[model samples]
Target: MDSEKLIHKITEKKALKDSKELLDYVSESGENTKEYIRYKTLWAMLQTGNEMDEETINDGYKAVKRNVKGRKSSLYINVVKYAAIVVFALLGGYFIHFADFNNEIAMNEIFVPKGNRTSVVLPDGSKVWLSNGTKLVYPESFVGDFRNVQLEGEGFFEVTHDKDHPFIVNVGKHRIKVLGTKFAVVAYPDDEQVKAELVSGKIQFDIHLGGTGDNYKSLMVSPMHSLVYDKTSGKVYDSTIPDGFYDYWQNGVYSFKDERFDSLATKIARIYNVEIVFGDEELKTRTFTGTLSVDDNIYTLMEAFKIASGKPFEYTFESGKIYINK
Candidate 1:
């Protein structure tokens, strides 16, 4: 295909007959490769008008052969660049897409560093707010029977309603299945427990059970309720949580009701991107009940703790860590 016509088809989001050739042409551009990449990625968005039906395109290596009799195009594979809005997901800032050359299948990933947050819009128009120290993985497009995503750390999702395409979030051995729901997930790989809180819509929390791993039980979660599953014991703790507690960190406000300082240290570390050490074990038992703004300096927060405790304790910063003592 001529470069001009090939480029024109892409702008229209049409299926490509020679996807490999397109990549070769792009790679041969040398110094202009970056520009070419940006150009192609610019049109990555799925369009509404004059759109090529997805069934016309063959994606992935096996998919090409499976759909050979019905294929209209070879493969419509496009590279995902940093900060590009993809038909799969609107990934802003630092993001990476890994693909298999044989198959047009690409796995997209986004990481939010400590002390930061990112918001993304999926192709289905579902919105996700990723918390600091979080990583989310999804495909270049929703394929097969379900829309699957892997989440590590924490994220808040306002999922678009799609009865046919159920949105499923995989966190370790568990899964949160929903059809148009608002929820928050806390499932850091390093943590001993995983939690899912439903904000508005309903969700089904699937917990892996039995020794063989095939046995499982699904619990329907209602709005304003949270399910915390302990990793080792396989215990699920169901409780009611305040409406705004799950998403308050997005606004830089940390609210809690009589939560222990030590219990909250790990979250604080993620917010401030620092390590917290308790020099005095006694101080860890002290519970705090209030709201804290991320805008406050570390010292101001320590002072607030001092006021809450009604006594003077010592806090020092050293070795990129904060040490609190009595």
Candidate 2:
């Protein structure tokens, strides 16, 4: 077929008589013609006001086959051309017509470094507040059996639950299942423990870290409840989380009730992107019980600790390290 004839057929001005010749021409056309044929045929098939039949659909496949594989140089290549056309046809259909792909898909990822905070929305109508040095992966659209997302570092999730599709948040070695619930996750690699604090509704916490992973059970809880799974202890501690603790992230406050200095420092490190070294082993082992506002800089937060402990902490802004002295 001539170039003009090809264009006429693509423009739908001329009817496709021999689907074989049209297919061959599409298969051997140059890059520009190949793209034109691919998009034009796609638009022809999918565009509103057009009723696509088998011949036009076959032409669409032929267009994709030609565009994806360029020109064949051998007889064997020609023999396999039909199979390649079928593959491209199915793949193109999935890409353009798949409903799941059209909705809540994670198209990009955002990372929040330590000493920072970020807010993000998932494909579902859920909101997530990512704590410092956290990574969240989500789709641009939400489809399939469950609305799921993977979380690293720490984050607070306010999920908009769909009864047909449960929202699943995957933290390191732990999974939170909820339909519509608000909760916070504190899990850092440097820390020996992971915590999930529920603010409202109910959540199912699955402890996936154990000798026999399948032997572990799931714990269901409501607001003011918490589940702390410790890796070193091989235990999941359930407790009534203290008031004001759940709102810490939102209010720029961090509350610790008799939490050891080492664990507390780990949390601070993730939030502030700072390296805290304890000079005295005893001081590092000391436990702190109080509430400090993170709104101020690290120095100010340390000052609060100093008054509570009756000790002074000297930190160097240049070195990003802190020292406790009595």
Report the C-alpha lDDT of model 2 over 54-110, residue by residue, as the tens digit: 664567556655655445544324323333333433543322121121121213344
Best by lDDT: 1
TM-score of 1: 0.73
Alpha-carbon TM-score of each model against the true structure: 0.73, 0.63
Clashes in candidate 2: how many? 14
Please give the lDDT score for candidate 2. 0.62
Q: Scored by Cα lDDT, where does model 1 land?
A: 0.67
List the lowest-lDDT window of 10 residues for candidate 1.
75-84
1-326: candidate 1 lDDT, tens digit per residue: 44344555455543322467555554454433444433343344223211122432223223434433432343222222111233223222334343222244345566767766656555566777776688887664576778999999998898999889899999977899999988999999999999999988889999888566656789988788999999888888999977458437456677888888887788788877778898878788888888776566877887778788855688888877998888
lDDT of every predicted structure (CA atoms): 0.67, 0.62
Give the Å error, residue 90, model 1: 17
